[model samples]
Target chain A: MVLDGIAKTALLGVEMGMTLVLVTVGLTLIFGMMDVINFAHGSLYMLGAYFGLTVVSVTGNWWAALLIAPLLVGLLGGLIEYFSIRPLYGRNPLYHILLTFGFAIMLHGLVTEIWGGQVQNISTPALLDGSVDLVLFSYPLFRLFLLGVSIAVTAALWLAIRQSDFGIVMRASAHDSEMVNALGTDVKRVFTAVFVLGSVLAGLAGVLLGTSQAVDPGMAASIIIQAFAIVVIGGLGSYRGAVVGAFIVGMLNAFGPTFAPQFTDALLYLLMAAVLLVKPAGLFGNPEAT
Target chain B: MSVKDIVGRHFSAHAETDVLSGRVRLGLFVAGVVAVLFAPVAQMIHPFWMDLVTHMFIFALFALSLDFVFGYAGLLSFGHAAMFGAGGYAAALLIQNVTSSALLVLPAAVIIGAIVAAIIGWLSVSARGIYFAMLTLAFAQLFYTIAFNDIPAMLLGVDAVTNGDNGLVGITSLTLFGMDTGSLMSYYYLALVILAGMLALVTRLANSPFGRVLQAIRENEDRVAFIGYNVDRYKIVAFTISGAMAGLAGGLWVPFNSTATTSMLHWTTSGELIVMTLLGGMGTLWGPIAGAFLVVFLEDSLSAIGNWEIYLGIVYIVIVIFAPRGLAGIFQTVRSNPHPKVLLSRVRSALVTYREKVFS
Candidate 1:
């Protein structure tokens, strides 16, 4: 029975970790690239879920919703970047935080107006529904699929950000945008693209997690803190740190109740504080980033 | 001139002139308080409005505390509610267990707020800019969860400490010299006097040499450090002072609110504090007070209708983008450019030029 519990927890933890990995990567990417800490990243996730919900209803296909919702959210993100965030470039990053915060609040209200304040639930697809018989315990198939999707996405992001031609340009810009600009690359376009990509990841996470959780206007506010904590723990803007931090937080979230049920919600934040104290730059992050 | 320079010149001009018309702003503060108080007496103000203004008084203190740290030290804390909530919870616990006298409770609240803030500031002052903000946020959220889960109660093996989500209730009457402050008028007076004192105190601090050094740190930390100021120590002190003030605001809230909930410690409170601070204007002590009044008023009036936040958010964005100096700056501009035609033309040209920058 204990073995079954352990296996079940392991799977759930991995699933939760993957979902968080998706969210934090997007968050860290934006911060790394643009010096913009987007409080509205979670709002984009909420929008993604809401849009995915719509897509599912319209097409009667969860897979289609998965594919299209992020694109829609990404498009909206692109527009937001162009109109609202563009003007604030080269100014104080304080304005970026406030501007994104405004978007988060406004988007929450907009979602509430459109979808009502009630919690909405999305059912897993029939193919991924029900439990799979693993050796130790039967676990939900959709969660495994979520884990798979998360890995696929991570691999893609890693390749795109680390290996591709665009990746070199993106990395170079992040290192020294002034240099990149002098080299004839328009850093502005790079910023918008990166911001949109972050939005898409948020959307993807929203859709994946919405299946297992409640989808409401408050989703943005609730999850953003967790994402913030994850990135901070992993060391802000470090990709490897995000993945590692996500699992640490995910396992804690999944299994913390058994040991300290009272502080399950607080453990991640506590850990982030500890990390900030011991290693302010985060374990994987460069010291100067802090 | 290029549009960028034209727009920049306009904003920079305000920078030179808006050193806060000291007496005029203080005069406005006194006048604002009187209007708020007298309007209710004139039978023109609803009890709801009365409550809103009182709420505004508490938030004004909260906003002022934030401005003390942010405007002066340039430390953008995203989790100020940690202190406010600590002060509130401290007051609640004190009233329940120790004393009913708010005189005693409020002071204790300040001490507790200062202590908590000192620790937070000591830890967070290492990082600059947004990194500092995230640290404060993490610490605040830890406090939030502790309160939300009533970790103290669990540790003590009691029924509840913060009472979790239902909040610590039955904290309705605050006593002054063993007399129950049952009437709304007494509560109103209590909140008003404390708020005014804080306003005066913060204004005095802002004008002090300490305040100037904090501003110096805000402009350039390296320069301030090079000039022999212990930058981190100053930031921590400023943050602690801000926390103490926030605590008083929190303690004051329990009497009016009749309950202290975990939301008091939530990041949204911190976010709203920033919004309120920015709306009034930063770098000026009175700006936050003005911001609090306007925002609290708008919030209350619009509570009946859903989606008011969207509009407020839009307004905040516009204010952040075009009117960085906020309401205080606008007031300064109107005062300086008394001629409506000149003011209108200046605004029109600035807007047109700014639009070109945004589009181009």
Candidate 2:
């Protein structure tokens, strides 16, 4: 029975780990490329879930909304970047921090205002509705589906960023935007694409999260803090680091509760603090970046 | 005109003017305080407004302390609530366990705030910029959880410590020499005296060599380090001082509300102080006070309306976009203008040009 419980816990950990990996990778990509610490990343995720919820409610099809919601979020993100964040470029980073934070608050407030403060739950798709018997215990099939989706998404993203011509441009821009611009690449277009891509990833996470757990007004702040912690732990701007960091956090989140229920929530951050103290540059952070 | 020359000319013009206007500004500051002091009596019919002003002053202290870290030290702390919460907890605990003497509790609150700040400063000062901010925030959240979830059971038994989520109830009223003078009138006066003393200290410290060195560090930390200053030590000290002052505000809040809760230590509380400092204008001594007043008033009046968060979010967006320097920045521009009307016109034209060139 104890062994069964442990296996079940490990499975749950893997599923949670996948979700964190998705969110952290998107955040790291944005931060890596722009040197912009996006305080609004979680808001984008929340928006995705809300938008997905709205779509699902209308069409009564969860999978369709999951696919479409992120595209819409991506467009909105591009517009936000075009208007609000552009002015703060080359200014004090505090300006960016405040601007993004203000944007986040506005988004959260709007979400709360439009859709009352009540929590909304999204049912798992019909195909993944039941539990899968895993030897001695049963686990939710939808969680396994989420894990599969996340793995596919991560692999697809890796290939897209590594092999495509656009990836070449993106890498060059990330290394030195000024140099890329000097080389006559359309830097603005590249940045817009990257920003939208990052937003879509965040939206994807939100859709998956909404399906896995309930959605509510307060979820934005909670997820954002967790994402930030994940990013920090993973080594800012390092995609692989984000994946590794997310699993570590996920397993800790799942198991820490059984040991120290009260301090369970804090364990993730404590891990981050320890990691940071030991490796100030993070697990994957370039020493030169700091 | 080159950028350096223009900057030099601007400073030279203002340098002489400041010497002449110091007395005027000081007089105005005093007059402003006096008006605030008399406001309750003048508006005795509206205790609601008096309460709002009182709350504003309490928060203004919080904002000012935040500016010390943000504006002066160039550190954006996410855990400033540590000081604020520590102060509140200290005062509440002291009131409950030791004595209800306002004087004793007040000083004790500051000491408690300082100790908490010292601990946090030690942990956080090693970091810079966003890392520092996030770490502080993480620590602050941990502190909040400890207070809200863990402390009640561990420190004061399950029902004893904070009264749980219901919060500490029936805090002892302020008594000076066994006289019950703990009315709103007295609280207002007490807050005013404390605010005045704080402002005086801030001004003195701001003008002191220590303050200049801190500003220099803000401008160029590497350069400051090269000049043989212990950069980290100075940062720790400045952060500790700011934390202590925030705690002072927290301590005062206990009597002002006659209760203290874990709510005082939440990230939202820290965010509010940041907003106040930003709104009032960072770095300016009185800017935080003004910000506190404006934000508190806005929140108070707007909370009655549905979707006040939307309004606040809109306000924050607009201010950050248009008034990055905040209200005090506007004051500075007006004060500096040789011809205020012409300057206003020039600003308007400049805005139009900026819209055409960049924003639009």
lDDT digits (tens) for residues A199-281 of candidate 2: 99888888899988988988878888788888788788777778878888888888877877767766776777766777766
DockQ of each: 0.71, 0.48
What candidate 2 gets wrong by more than 4 Å, as runs, is A287-290, B1-24, B27-31, B34-37, B155-166, B338-360
Residue A127 lDDT in model 2? Answer: 93
Q: Encode model 2's per-residue lDDT on B1-360: one tens digit a residue.
A: 899999999788656433214754676577566756676674667766666677777887888788887878888887889789888878888888898887888888888888888887788778887788877887787777777765557654555565545667667666667765467666766677777778778767766678878888889999999999998899889988888898899888887787888788777777777877887888876777888888888777877876666777778776776778888877777767869787879688857744653453
For B164-202, candidate 1 gives per-residue lDDT tens digits of 998888886689987887666677677777887887788
Top candidate by TM-score: 1
TM-score of chain A of each: 0.96, 0.95
Error of 2 at B180 (Å): 3.5
The structural similarity of chain B in model 1 to the true chain B, as TM-score, is: 0.91
Shift of residue A89 alpha carbon in model 2, Å: 0.8
Off by over 4 Å in 1: A287-290, B1-23, B29-33, B36-45
